[model samples]
Target: MSKLQNVFFPLLAVVAAFIVGAIVIAAVGDDPLFVYGLFFSSVFGTIDGLSYTLFYATPLIFTGLAVALAFHCGLLNIGAEGQLQVAAFVCAWIGFTFNLPGLLLVPMCMLGAVLAGAIWAGIPGLLKARFGSHEVINTIMMNFIAAGITSYLTQYFYREPGDPILQTKHIYEQAHIARIAKLLSPLGVDLPQRLPLNLSLLIALAAAGGTYFFLWHTRWGYDLRAVGANPAAAQYGGVNVARNIVLAMCISGALAGMVAIGEVQGYRYRYYEGFSAGYGFTGIAVALLGRNHPLGIVLAALLFGALQRAGLFIDIFTDRVSKDLTVILQATIILFVGCEELFRQLKRRWAKPA
Candidate 1:
């Protein structure tokens, strides 16, 4: 496919998605214009709402990047959900238990989350590399394990004493995220001081650029891509396929871990049962929709984030449509994007030789 076609296809898919969404809205007797109006207001009507939406998008960027990175290496990292949970729990543990200055405490909590995520993802990688196990199976099962274990830890160990809910104690105030409205309090938002779009967003952006550089600009990245493209050929070319597989999973897991950074360090500043809400699963769609490009993943994450923000707004105004609309839209987009590679291949083959 030509470069123009490559770009055109995604735009077409988006237009199709909107048309479908409009049809659904009509069937439900909800006005699409009203839904869109609320969406616009929620996102841009007030600085506070926009702040929340972008803050929500921050962690998604990390998880999206995580899934995209693994997909590039031909690995199906179904474990991102579990990896993120473990990272969040670990970050909470460090945040609540450790007594350190703000500078050291913050970085330490982040480091702990990253390490936990790496370890969580590494388990499946090690299995796949050594035993030739299918990562799809191993990673999926690992996600369940991570969820169960993290829930148990949150309930038994991390749960804030005297609180009935399954949640951790608040992290030290020093570790709390800086809110944008609070930072610029003289210019107050109409609502309460909005949470700042955290440092994690910056970190996520950096990760994307860093991944792009590693994948397209570095020797190791070349080896990883070569292995992903064809393991037997890469092995023949002296790339250590086993080592690369493990490394890819580790890096992927680390990115997943950073998702917890946004949610825990920036948003909640604590861990809770069911805090993640299936970010890992959404990440798979993100990876496919992004064509596994780092920059593309950022865009995809924002799209999904916008849908989520809009979904909440839609729900507020209409009893007919639920937030599930956003999920359906996301699923539809993924289906189309997943088929895109096949379409591109067909186009390549159909083009006659000059």
Candidate 2:
């Protein structure tokens, strides 16, 4: 598909999703306009809402990029959930165990997080490459294994003495990333401290740029993309498909691990059980809606983040409509995007300019 169509279909999907959502609301006898107005207002009108939206967007950005990168390599990585869980645990472990100064400790924790995720994901990658196993099945099974292993480690070794929460001991302050509010306060932005938004957002933005450059500007990335586009042709042209598969999964997992930077270092400051709110699965939808493109992924993540924030507001402030609308909308969006083939005819008449 051309760039314009790549962008257009997702936008059309989003519009179609909201239309379906509005219909559902109207079917339930609530004014669709009232519900949607309230929802969008809550997401955009208040600083708290916007800040929280961006905070939530941080992880989605990471996970979305992870999924998108895998897509670029013709790989389906459903293992981001497991990859992130393992990485978060490792990050917390490094944080508390090392207790080094910020200059040293923070980077060490980040490196640990990335390596943990890479190793976890690389297992499935290796299995696929060497044994001809399906990555989807391996990755899904790995999620369960990761959850059990992380839970055991936290319960037996990392949990604070007698703590009721299924979480590890807090990382030292030196490991914590300053919240965006604190960082901005020195420059007079003065955002409320309650907002969990942090430097991870900047990291996400940089990741997007880096992903774009890697996928479009580099020889290695070109080989990976060629493999994804046509593995048989890629091999005929001297690209090593197996190595790229493993390498792509490792890179994808590394991106997924960046989620720990936000969750462990920015907000919770610990490896908390159930910290993720289906970020891995939601990322699949984000990547689809973004057409597996980095810039588009960032935009899609923001939209989902805003929708997430609006869903919470609907739960709290509305009596007739519920947060389930957001779920319905998201599902509809995915369904619509999956039907992009329906746009093929139009694209013949509207091909993107070179």
Candidate 3:
């Protein structure tokens, strides 16, 4: 595929999904243009809206990159959901239990999250490498295991006394990440104080940049990609295929773990039960739409983040259309992108040979 096709294909998929969405809106007795305007405005019109979009995008960015990294290694890491859950729990556990100063506690919590996620994901990776088991099955099983274990642990050990909620105690203040609103107050940009946008956004961006560098510019990345392209060939060429497989998953899990920084430390300040809201699964869509590139992932994450932020307004403003329309649109985009090969074949059949 050409560079133009790389950029054009995803954009075409997005436009096609929106076109279908507009038709659905019209069928529901609403003006498609008006509904779309409301959607766009709610996500991008004001500072609060944009901040919320960015806040939502932060986790998607991490999870998207995580999936992309594994995808590059010819692996489907469906366990990102589980990995992130475990990581969030570990991070929250550290935050609530530790009494260190801000500088010490924050990084320690992050490290805990990363290690927890890596270990959770590494099990499936090890299974795939050592036992020749399929990662997809193992990762899916791990998601369920992670969910059950985390729920049990939270209820048994961390639940606030007599509260009846499945969540940990509130984290210490020093462990909390500073919200971007507060950080910008000194610079005269008066963002909404309540918005969840935080320093984690910068961390997410840094992760993207680092991923691009690591994947395309480093020797280790080449070996990983080589293993993905052809494990037998890579091994014949002296690359350690098994090691790279495990390493790829470890790195993927670490990236997914970063989501906890935004959700647990930055916003909730607790490990709330079932707080994921499907960010990990949505990340697969984001990674596919982004073509597994860091820059593309950021843009795709922002688009999905905006859609999430807009869903509430769509529910309130439209008569017959519900927030479920966003789900439909997302599904449509995924369908179209996944069928790109079919479209390309049809295009080829219609074109003259050079």
Least accurate stretch of 10 residues (summed lDDT) in model 3? 345-354
What C-alpha lDDT does candidate 3 achieve relative to the native structure? 0.93
Best by TM-score: 3
Q: Candidate 1: deviation at residue 302, Å?
A: 1.1
Q: Candidate 2, 34: how far from true, in Å?
A: 1.9
**Which regions of candidate 1 fall more than 4 Å away from where they truly are?**
182-192, 341-354
Per-residue lDDT tens digits for candidate 2, residues 1-354, read 577777778998899899999899988878888888888898889999889899988899999999999999999999899999999999999998887899999999899999998999999999988998999999999999999999999999889999998999999999999899999998988788888999999999999999999999999899999989999999999999999999999999999999999999989999999999888888888899988889899999999998888998787777678988988888899898988776665666588753
CA displacement after TM-score superposition, residue 274 of candidate 3 (Å): 1.8
Candidate 2: global Cα-lDDT? 0.91
What TM-score number comes out for model 1? 0.91
Report model 2's TM-score to 2 decimal places: 0.95
**Would you list the rank order by lDDT, best first?**
3, 2, 1
Ordered from best to worst TM-score, the candidate numbers read 3, 2, 1
Pairs in steric clash, model 3: none
Candidate 1 lDDT, tens digit per residue, 1-354? 466775667766666677788788788888877776776788778766766677767777788888877777789898899999999999988999887888998889889999999999998999999999999999889888987898788888878678898888888766655555555556664436545577777788899899999999999899988889999999999999999999899999999998877788888888988887678888887777666888777887887777777788777778698888888888778777767776667668889664
In model 1, where is the ten-residue run with the lowest total lDDT?
Answer: 187-196
Per-residue lDDT, model 3, residue 103, is 99
In model 3, the Cα lDDT at residue 128 comes to: 91
